[model samples]
Target: MAGSNFGTAAKIAAPLVLGGAAILAGMHRWESQELTVYADQLAGGLPTYCSGRTQPPRPVGERLTQARCDAIDAQTATEYGRAVLACIPADKLDQNSFDAFTLFAINVGKSAACGSRAAQLMRAGNREAACKALARGPDGRPVWSYASGVFVRGLQSRRQYEANWCLTLAEAP
Candidate 1:
């Protein structure tokens, strides 16, 4: 306790830091609704932590190989994760928040959603505004696509849910 090295200090402080980050992240980030809906949009039918499509979009494990099959799974998740995380600057988000946010990013696609005003505002450190920005599209038009709106809403929901989960975890024995 008195003379701890990095390992001891890190073990003690890491949870505290993670808790604080989760609270801060939940403070202004998306909710579970946004994440789930967005996930559904992109997944179409798939669920969380998905891997190896039952009927892959393209050949795998045979011509391309099982490694490719697994790669496809990882690639999908990673792409979405990058997109979500990219929407917000690294400094602004904590670990748990980032996990939830990544769900949204994966579904919406970094190029499409992050390019929107929502991502722009989020990256600028105004997450609430960024979320509001999602209410509509670049055309300044109503969210004509239900899938689009659901995707945004789901992402928002997931962020909140993950943040809440972190809080719960922090309180656990």
Candidate 2:
């Protein structure tokens, strides 16, 4: 019977695994692809490049080919996906939920996303609350929309968008 349960689980998870390409394509609209390295003055001059990537920041004015940017984006998505998945059970996640969480992780770093109230609610099997938590916390205020202790409008918009994405499979008002 346990083997049968595993098979059932695999069947449920198959679509999510197969939807990787679609998710990647959908994410493009949310992530801007800049071929040249630039510093994000909004985030205290955080060096960024290649679709909002901010790791091993390249020197300012450095340029990369579209192919290289694509590669880096793919690699970063995969890395962040693994990190997010490590903290959330695969069995509990629909493709939309996973994509939303992965997007959040990409923006806020894996540790921050994984440790967030959203992740906690999801892990506790409360999908509705989890989606709402992405936008606001227990205080009924926006969360994760701050940079250097100041609220950022763009980040707030992104968080609300991600929250809506998370509610795709759920009935939300």
Models 1 onward score TM values of 0.40, 0.85
User: What Cα-based lDDT does every candidate model obtain?
Assistant: 0.42, 0.78
- How many clashing residue pairs appear in each of the predictions shown? 24, 0
Error of 1 at 106 (Å): 1.9
* 54-149 per-residue lDDT for model 1 (tens digits): 333332222444455345545554555555654556554434434444534444445766676656665666543444455445465434134523
Q: After superposition, which runs of candidate 2 have C-alpha atoms over 4 Å from their true positions?
A: 1-15, 170-173
Can you write out model 2's per-residue Cα lDDT over 60-107, one digit (the tens) per residue? 889999999888888887888888789988876777778888888988
- Which candidate comes out best when scored by TM-score? 2
Error of 1 at 161 (Å): 6.1
> What C-alpha RMSD separates each model from the true structure?
11.5, 6.0
